[model samples]
Target: MAQLRYIYSMPVERIVRYFNDNGFHVNKATANGLLSKTADMFENLYTALGRAVLEDNYISCDETYYKVMDRTGNPDALNINKEYIWAMFAMNLNLAYYFYENGSSRGDVIHKKLEKYKGTVQSNGYAPYKSLRGEILRVSCFQHCKRKFLDLQGNPDADKIIELINRLYQQEHKHCIGADEWTQEDNLKWRRKYSKDIMKALKVALKRIISSPEYPPKSQMYTAANYMLGEWKGLENIFSSGIYKLDTNTIERLNRYISLSRRNSLFFVSHRGAERGAIFYSLACSCRLGGINSFEYLSDVINKAASLPPDTSLEKYRNLLPDKWSKK
Candidate 1:
């Protein structure tokens, strides 16, 4: 039973090795078989997390790559497919939900998932997300803008960009009333007072750098300048509300497990296996965010899941969610 919990936190091969070291021999296939049999429980838990995230007023979207092993039609050929897993997290709710298309991370999946969403989305400058500018409030990631310049260290132009961005972050820190205590009204007022001017100055600086012939088009400074200028409108959207975050760092932090899992496990054997992995990780991370003991929560949910009808409505099991279940 305890070994089942480890599956979400580590690769199955590690779990099998741990069991073998402890005088029990288990194979990777058997470990995955256990997870596969409990697919209903994972799906139900993921559904609950999804519902919670969707209920929030602010969301952060981020994506990371995962590898999937694709069995080609030609018997002689084997292909390792590159796939993307996207996470849409609710900042206020401290919940996250993940999704992966069969093998693609294009605009269609973005459109389908967020079609009904109607709040500010904080993400890096991805064109698919940018396309939703009119449909939803698009807030750019400041960390992304800073990263572009950070890569060009020692360049005078890049240093200037980093310094200006740091100053803007300093204003945010200065205006924050207390640790996580700033109310929406106070945040909006503080941004208007301190951040608006910095944003205006940044726009001017970016335009001038981008227009200058001193740097070639292919140079990092030119690229950084162009990125910032192109994303200016979305970046300025930060000033529209105090509730909007400067970056998607919150959700990005949640991605460490997924990234680590990819590195350890290498690749999912099939598309269905990848989806199951997504479901398990979603539940585990959401539990961590909600301060629930995921092992206990999963045990309880698994017991309850056994009694549920095949077509159980996810809404009916909402109480099983980490936040609500933890209260019990």
Candidate 2:
């Protein structure tokens, strides 16, 4: 019931009424308790998911804001502070992990979380992402670059840039038609054969626009060109591996569920409450990615957790992961 409420973005009051109308006669307090306890039951599984994502060789990352209510004051008073929820997605494994850090979005927070991670991280050109340890290779999102020029549609230079970008997307679309059957090496060869020339042309066009005096330094076209040039190396890294995506669109789409929940629930009553939401979101989104029914997955796992000993091994908990559980 709690999973359904959150997954569907139905508020607790509505969920409670739904049960009462169906003759279950449950109250709001009972519903809230069920939701909290259910999240607690899945805490261990959430940790295992995080470890899996961090250990993977490639992942995408993004963050969104949530309003966390301040619990240090009067209960009736409105004391909301803006907090961030960070998401990390392992594409190859079909797993998603979410985390909260006392509402901090600092560079050190990222460094602390990913200090030992030695893999490619895909994200937008967030400044903090650039400060990641030398071991981590950062990949910039093309959609972000396109959006900058997309906003300046009236300019001829912006139009030309858009045309070139569309051509690149067209090549990607063609490659994607039977992408599932292609090996990583096959993908690499395809991109080298097709995408290499388009990217070279894009670089040349960006350089031409940057040198032209018609577009002022402060103009949107100039800024967009400079932005692409600055991220040119990271953008070019797409050719480095076929596993990397052209954009962080996968994780960005995953983040919309968090946005939807926030729109419905408004603010969590405490930091712990926000943490609980993170756990549920992680599992639910992973299940959705794996094409599993979240309610069945959660229900079975919660029951399995109840049957297991408190001192169960980490391997046992890992077996309950979405992908592993789906195979059963």
Candidate 3:
């Protein structure tokens, strides 16, 4: 099942065929039954990963949509419902948590997921983040801001803004010696000396673009300039702290597998199935983030969780986490 889901990402039909070809005569029904039963074990790993992600002083979050079979009958509803799969991971730590939200209410769901979190959350400039401004430090992704202007390439004002942002990135690239080699204090010093000046220039460029006659109200340039101006504080937050990242590109890269799985399998049969998939994906990502072997990590986690009492507390479960268990 782990091989089919995590390694190959094989659908049920393909999984059954692979087993049958290997001399095991398991059919699709049998394969699915086994898969469903493993949800409990997957939940154990997912819950542990979630706790670790929330405990971090910093995390990056993003969500993608997936189709689910709908049981509800709203007047405006179609045969299927669009559900959101949120990926939130610790920025400095090797942990990722995937969550399934069956509705479109981003504000409430984000608040619930990050209820007690007091650290900065770096995300693409989504309006829902406005709700979290007071509760936690809101940070915007420069990559996202740059992408918006990249779409309007012919405009001079847009080109200037992009050039300014490029300079900041160049400064970052110059100092980066990989996280393993670079000291945080040195990194902070470089950013303060160089990146801060470029950001100040970018701010001035943004105001110029907003005031320019070339950027009419409701135009794409106007919208892009407005967004950058509105989220300036968040974008500037990275300069204030060495720990803050320039973008949420790390978590965005992790979402590639989710996209691949969705394209292949189409839609989950049920919400329960979707949640189970989230559990598996979370554990799989946790393994990748921690540099642990997925097969070994999943096998050990399932085995250890099964050996314990069903009523075990989160503390006991934490010991079995990949980062913790790997040391043992």
Candidate 4:
């Protein structure tokens, strides 16, 4: 299992060639079987880990495009949509899982999948999770919130926007740093003061954008301006809540793996394949982050899933979690 995990984490050609060359020297049929099974095994391994996730954790999610070959055609290639990610939160601090699918994810898709999530979720200005209402507290990623003003940094008119956003960040970072000895309650209170600062900036930015010649409804900056306008409320959610740190760096860090894997492998065969890939990537990536040997984790899980009794199958899996493994 460890070997497979290691290979999946490797370049696709490397994985294919390793099996193909090594397989030919041994037995053709068996080697071909190994080669064919590589992607699928990886798919299952990821599903196992993703299913093992818990519900109470805060999650950060985002989607990116994956381009793949169209299986239905001959001599013609088309870009098929796959997943960039389906990440979950393990703790308040770390990214637990990242699932990569090969299609475009809409707001409804995100909403349906996350319906059971009970904790707060942090994301950029994606619309899917926007309308969902429940125990889930929604927070906007601060980095994205600041991006508009950051873009406006040289425009002079947007200088106030930049100043306010930066000030909020500086305030939070400073307070958190100086607050090493403070209680959680005090920390929450310490940060609450900046809630209005974000609103102030937003209002000012909006008025300027609306009155300017670049209102976006008819300008080249339309998409950027429109996205910011649509996401203003979500972005402001950060200050209203104390638990959320102002950035989606947690999930964006998860995006780095997506960037890595996709940069090399190209795309998936189908959306279904993409979905499974997402699950696998999530588990495998999480394993790497926790310093767990991903192959060992996958191999053990696959073997155990086949033979273990239902009652003990899951417990056995949990026992092997990286955090748990560390204690043993």
Candidate 5:
């Protein structure tokens, strides 16, 4: 069962063929059955997760594009567009998890983050979150804001704009890094300066794009310019509040784990199958964070959870963890 986790893909018959040709006796049905059984174990883990966590947990969400072939047997099936699926990861103190194939919009992800959330909410500046219209504490990521400018670093006109954006970022970052004993007037002064510079840069960049024939038709300039133009208020909103940040680095890091599974095989035949893969990925990510041996922990978790009283299994599992939980 543990060895199966490392196997990305192979038909059961191929493994059986290898064994048979090598004088081993593993049969076709048995190999297929074994695969199904291990898959079921992950499905069980998914069921266990839903009943495990309490309300004090954080569930951060984001979405990305997923591709699929149309079933109509067209020759262009490979190039056809499919749905955009969402993957939502719930992060609490003890564990983090993944749930997949839900809504995929800027609105849906933010809506999930805002829904019934009572504690601090950490995320990127994805517009729909702004309409959340609540007092929930939002901590955006500086890494996210900095990266937008970073993306435009090599851009000709955008290089100047990146510097301007960085200056705005740094002005607020200075306060975060203990630069101020600042007052309302000081903040307003900085904001007005940032807004004016942002407006000026946008005007210049737009004019340059309009007049320049040398610009690439689909280029970083438009991406950078449009973002600054559309998100100027949110970018400037950083200085107004002492708490709000410029991006959502936490979610970005979280994204790497859940998303890697998507990239590995490029597709899952069903959301349920993806759900099982997500459990393993979530566990792998959590184990990485805690500096535990993921395979050993998973083996221990699966082996032990199988024997514990079903009523107290999750509790028993929690107690067995090396981090602040009790003995097995």
Candidate 6:
């Protein structure tokens, strides 16, 4: 019932209706209680997944907004009605973790979450991401840079920049043929050999447009060029390793499930409900990524979790993760 509600985006009332139609009478409160209890069972495993993500070397980060009914009387709570849900995806491990901290999207929330992280973090170069601490190597999204110019369709300068960007992607596609068979060294060599020059040419073109007096500072062309130039370092970080993608497309694609759920169910009734939804969303999406049936996985784990001690070892919880559970 919980899986149907969260993973399948079925509202509780609709779920109850389906049950009643099948000759099983269930109330909305009972359905909500089941969801709460299932979330309690999955909470420990969710924490374990988060720890694993923080320990990973490569992570993609993104955030989306949600509406929450705030009953908290605190006047200074930032954007009480509008909350943000952040996602961290570990590419190497095929793991994902979602976080909702008091319905806050402030820099402090993310800064504290990633305080101990020390590896490459890929994002769209949002301002809050720039403020993250630790040994984090920030990588910007090329698609974001491309979109800036894409929005200025008729401008010749923007079109030229877009053409150069397309060439880089073409080279990337050519090298990615049978990429599953590629070694780290092979990926490194291909990027250095084929992509290096194209990136150099693109950089030069961006600088030329930035320095041109014809395009005013406030013009769309100038803004696009400046934005790309400002994010140049992060964009160039792609060549550092073949493991890095040109954008946060993978995580962004995963975020669609959150969007789907939001569109169907709308706002969470409280902060606690939002947090529980995060746990379900994290585990459900990770199950999808690992090609596991989420319903079966959740059913098994929820039972296993019930039989375990409250002080169960971290290893026990980790074994319940989607990838780990699928292997058994």
Best by lDDT: 6
lDDT of 1 by residue, 1-328 (tens): 3324333556777788888999998888887888888765567767777877877878899888889988858556678889988888888877778887886788888888888887778888999888973458888988899999999989877887888889878888775645577787898888888876787778777888888898789977889999988888888888888778788888888898887778777888878877877777677777778877777777778888788887888886777776677533
Residue 42 accuracy (lDDT) in model 1:
61
Off by over 4 Å in 6: 74-80, 177-180
- Stretches off by above 4 angstroms in model 3 are 73-78, 133-135, 177-182
User: lDDT of candidate 3 vs native?
Assistant: 0.79
Query: Candidate 4 lDDT, tens digit per residue, 176-199?
Result: 533566655665786777557666
lDDT of 6: 0.86
Provide the clashing-pair count of each candidate structure. Answer: 0, 0, 0, 16, 3, 0
Residues 1-328, model 3: lDDT tens digits: 7656754567778777888899999987787788777777657656877988888878898988777776665545555667888889887777888888673546788878787888888888777776684558888898888989999988788899889888887878876646668877888888899976787788888888889897797899989989988888888788887667888888988888778777777777777778878888887877787888888877777777778877888888877776777633
The TM-score of predicted model 2 comes to 0.94
Q: lDDT per model, in order?
A: 0.79, 0.85, 0.79, 0.59, 0.52, 0.86
lDDT by residue (204-299, candidate 5, tens digit) is: 765676457765646656554555455545554544544444555555565664345345545544444444555555555556556667667766
Q: Is candidate 2 or candidate 6 better by lDDT?
A: 6
What is the alpha-carbon lDDT for the whole of candidate 1? 0.79
Model 5, position 274: C-alpha lDDT score: 49
**Superposed model 5: Cα runs more than 4 Å off:** 1-60, 65-94, 102-114, 127-130, 133-135, 142-151, 154-157, 164-246, 257-263, 313-328
10 residues in a row with least lDDT, candidate 5: 1-10
Per-model RMSD to reference: 2.3, 1.9, 2.6, 4.4, 7.3, 2.6
Candidate 2: which pairs clash? none
Candidate 6: pairs in clash: none
Q: Across residues 1-328, which tens digit of lDDT does each residue of candidate 2 receive? A: 8577657767788889989999999899898898888888777788888888888889898989899998675877878999998889997898999899987888777778898998999888888887787688889889999999999898878888888888877877776524578777887787788877888889999999989998889887889999998888888887788778989999998899888878888888889988888898888898889998988888888889778887887678888999889534
